[model samples]
Target: MKTMTELMESNIKKNYVFSFLMNFRLSNGLWMIYMASRGMSLTQIGFLEGIFHVTSLMMEVPTGSVADLFGRKLSRSIGRCLSLVSILVLIGATSFFHFTIFMVLAALSYNLESGSGEALVYDSLKYLKAENNFISVLGRQEAIFQVSSVVALLIGGFLGTYSYHYAFWASSGIIAFSVVYSLSFTEPPILESVGRNSKTFRGFLKQIVDSFSLIARDRKVAFLIFFVQTILAFSACIFFYIQNYWKGLGRTEFQIGIYLAAGSFLAGLVAMKVQRLSHLLKEKKVLIILPLISVASMWGVALCSNKLPFFMVVAMIEAMLFVAGNDYINKLIPSRSRATIISFASMMYSLVMIIFFPIFGRIADTISFGVAFVSLAVMASCLYVLSMYLLKKIG
Candidate 1:
């Protein structure tokens, strides 16, 4: 086994670039959601988030094909550049229309990134004869990414307390650094064989079709994708409801930031240990347990009236299970079409969210936050059972 230090030295530049981009992107995650909520009505916030999902859904296949054809490195660079531009727009924007434009731009950038970066990293590892270690490497990368998220959340929250645009401005600067890093990235030679034919628009479409067809042909992949969609939908509801939940607890945006940071920090720590955990627990078993734990955590969120204990438990659950679940999903995916498959899976997830977020938000707005959360928990619990059964039958 490669020591962590050895892995870092061998892939220093690539890993650093990935870390920078993740830091830039995730640092603003909580802040952006907070801003959208503060700037607009809950309904509008839902709409904006839905738009982000819709844009990603629309772009998923095309962008996946772009990574497939043009090479993941090139596609990732373009995505990072677009992300930087989006952050800049968010910094300058004030009006609802302007915010919408920024949201759309940001969504575009995220859609471009959905799978390209991981594909590039996987391809690079293959070149280095470390393909067999992809799961552990990916887990490590996720840990780094989550650490960046924790840092970014802390900083962004502080800035957001002053002004949301302050957070946006800081995010823009981070994205600029990410863009620079991405531009310097070199594609691994293994990708060259896959890039034999010069790519055309028509070829890109065909590749998209082929990727989707391949996914459909594999029962395991199809079931996993649907399972991922269900899990993400529940996850989305919890995250989306957090702002409102914190408000009920009389927490300031800064305090909420602290809570978000705590969760992410824990997630980072757990992500680092995922490979070891996977060795002890089968991936399918982990998947089932993770979502169940997530459901229980959300139920705890629904029940808690206090702040510190609420946040602590939430962070613990997220770190121990949620991050581990994500790492397992990454491990299950095949290297050759990892990005495209991930993108396709994400697109389906977004499609589900695009429909569900609005309804869930409206329910939170009209009925009760607790009601929406509990409903999600119940649905997630059911999905966990279903996923376990499916995986068992398939295996």
Candidate 2:
């Protein structure tokens, strides 16, 4: 048997490799900008966003189940391959139709990776009886993931200034490394041995149903899932448009890159401190209050004449949604359906994104960013009230 130190060292290596690869997309900070630059309308961009989520909503649960049954290492390898192709397609895409098609493929790539890595690391720790480290380790992994994104955002901006093609090409090259890493990455022997417990299709379907039943019966789980899905989905759609919003504010491409990099740095720092914050506030209050803070910051963006508050709030949103909230949920869930249940939350977010992204896009096109954001704030406020009822029950 491997020593705990040995397993942890391997796990951290996999974590950084995958984390870096995941955020290394060259189109990330500039995608909506690139699409718009090609003469696509705001609504068109929104429609593509909706399509991406539709793809993800369809695939999230099944791919997650596959990870649970087969092993994260194999599932992640498949995801990395799809992600690589998706970026290549985007790099070569010349028309709106091509972009849409490539985005659908990219959605598939995200699903394959979504719950797989977290499941791998968490289960590996469980097997090693080192569950205590899961939160801090996961938090650290989550935090630095954004650090890589700062690199991607800067790279995308720098290359995109000359030509978007350069950025796209560079992103694909970075992901090539991740693809190799994924294939070579080892699953914990315990997880590899789980294939023996793999279920038939019928059994898998039953497990999904039972998982939904668990959600239905457990108000805390259901609420947490609902709360995270709603706010994250809303904020994600909002964040995507912020690139254009910056353009509207008279910022140049390079200036936008600097803003993104600065915000990302703050987000990384906040994510690293998530465990400490959780300890200070406690998880229940964290869930309760952070969402409120997130909503307020989002609304503050709409209300502010200056964009600095929006940038600060954007950092908070990233830290809260991606890093803090996710680790908190991980702590609550049992191992057996961990990936499946997390995917369910993710799937729900995809569904919400599908429904609302286009609507918000149209609003931004027809009206203004401020008006669209105000609408989001109203929706978020109502949801926050409802979430409080559920958050109280979690503990």
RMSD of each: 3.7, 2.2
State TM-scores per candidate.
0.88, 0.94
lDDT accuracy of residue 280 in candidate 2: 97
lDDT of each: 0.68, 0.79
Off by over 4 Å in 2: 1-5, 189-199, 393-395
User: Which residue pairs overlap in candidate 2's backbone?
Assistant: none
Model 1, span 1-395: residue lDDT tens:
76544443455357754774656543354544555555766667677778888888999878877776667778877888887887777666666677678778877777677778767666677666666576676667767776787777777777766777777766777777777777666655443344335276666666777778887788877887787666766665666567666766676767777777787677677766766776788776676665666667766766665434544455545554534544544556555566777788778888878887877777777788777777766766677778788888988
List the lowest-lDDT window of 10 residues for candidate 2: 189-198
Whole-model lDDT, model 1: 0.68
Q: How many angstroms is residue 351 displaced in model 1 relative to the true structure, after the best TM-score fit?
A: 1.8
